[model samples]
Target: MTVTRDSITDFVRTLEDDISRVAICGTSYSDIGGVARVIEQQAIELRNGGYDIDIFTLEGTRKPPEDVSLHALGHFETSPYKEVDKLLTLASPSALNFVRSANRFDLIITHRFPFSTLGHMAKVIHNVPYVYWSHPSGSSDELFEGLAHAWARVQHHLETQNYAVRKADYLCAVSEESGEYIEAKTGREAVVVPNTITESRFGDVADEKKINEQFGLTPHDTIVLHVGRISPRKNIHRLIEAFQAATEGEAECKLLLVGEESMPEYSDRVRELADDDVVLTGFVDDKTLAGIYNRSNVYATCSLSEGWGLPLSEASYFDLEIVAFESIPAVNSLDGAYPVVNEDYDEFREKLCEKVNRD
Candidate 1:
């Protein structure tokens, strides 16, 4: 994600005009996620643009920063409480009703999930101009011919996701590469607006030492951090394997998982992985997590796919050298994120060992 300053300047230009009312819809709004954080960043900017942003959340009441003026309207999952939320997503009927209630908005900006399907309905039914926000791709069609995947669910997801993108009045991608991928997939050129940074995590340097102490880590320990859903798409298991492999001889390395687990089986699997070196502190506060980022010896993810890796960007903000698989949407941004080809255990080991030895 090599960006010319002009592109950022131009993207900021679109916000000059005052926006009145906007329905910012997404499931992850209340949770700790890269995409959710990206959406939260936009909600703040839109609020500054004079738009009163009304959020349709799937769950939780975690408010956005004060300057952003965002409010959650709903929640979806129950267990980890923060488990996957589906606010206003087509998968839920409450979302359908929100679209009806949100008809007064001048525009709608959707991120990830249900927004794609609901945005179209918001337009066709209420005459609202829906803006489709693209984040990251969770697929690699390199193995498949024209279709993204031969698996029925993967194929269905693409077909459905394509319909949602093509139906939007305007599309804003989190990254230019994602925009190009969307254009090639849907025959519609989307506008690229990569995820912006909040001053605390990006503009200002974090106190890693302060944050690490709060996480119960000694100054000498090397804490490897991962922040994303504990779901399958994040490729957490692979990260565990890599970490286990990377730290066999290094006695000082530790791994900390910051987000809430997403599924029963997934949680069980991860819990099963608990041992001397791994710490699972499910869903810490943003301030605390930022502190942990500051204290990290290295930050990494083996995310198999993404719309864009928000954590990766945040990791870069802290200047922590990262290690990740290069295929993820955010791979392009990780100049410091040492990438290994996905599942290339050998190559992953090589990179991990190099980073550890260099550290």
Candidate 2:
């Protein structure tokens, strides 16, 4: 079922207004992550449509686009302070404050999974509704499919988080898998807003100049772009092997793992395996990422699972052929990329060669 906030009463669209103000709430936009990029992309589209946009962040780590207006809301606890957040969310006093503060927005959209519970509480407290962007990675049956014998506490947190997803005005996600998951948990139909890829990102920019200068890239080098937080869930190790295999005989191929390194150990592992052909940008800006995408020949993602792979869409904008696995959600998201089934080394290797050599 669809719900609306008290402030957003205007059903009629004003075509003449040059500024359509929109607010985006989320955990962190600093890492150039999926949720951040989703909101940012929409904000850009609206701005291009001659609408003024506003993005509200509790932490305010990342800056909004130059054209978009920015409003800083109250800050919340980080990952380490999860318990504190849960406590404040439950207590009536703190909950009342949350409602009072967010009542001003015409439409408040949140990316945090637990914030949906806040949205439910806020609607009752302030009569202001909220739209939730669904991207929860865990299954309701479990936090994740594969887990150890331990993690009882983690499992409990996962269950409580579903309460948030279960309550929201509008549920939006990038793919059907996540949409289905949100519907099953929220008892609401979710809109499928596939990730976007504009033509401008596949061009040169000032951010690339900074990255090239800092990373020591030659004009002739072909950088293979992997844009995301370098995490195990991302299956970064598999990408290493695939890139390594593809660049075996190639002269200019270089694997560029953009975004900050998730862990120092993982960062070290990347270095241990790389010859001189690998470059780690470690949290490059958006413009740099776009330039890297332009200079890149092919894009590859070795994720075990993905609700929606945003980079895959970005690659499509540049017409870069994809080399991915033939899994349910992954294959479905690739659109028309060459997907090789099975994770066997040889099978993956053969497919990798095919993608890299494509004319």
Choose the strongest candidate by TM-score.
1
The positional error of residue 351 in candidate 2, measured at the CA in angstroms, is 1.6
User: How much does each candidate deviate from the true structure in C-alpha RMSD?
Assistant: 5.1, 5.7
**Residue-by-residue lDDT tens digits, candidate 2, 199-232:** 4444555555555677788776666777777766
List per-prediction Cα lDDT, in the order shown.
0.68, 0.61
Q: What TM-score would candidate 2 get against the native?
A: 0.75
- Tens digits of lDDT, candidate 1, 224-254: 8888778766767778888888888788888
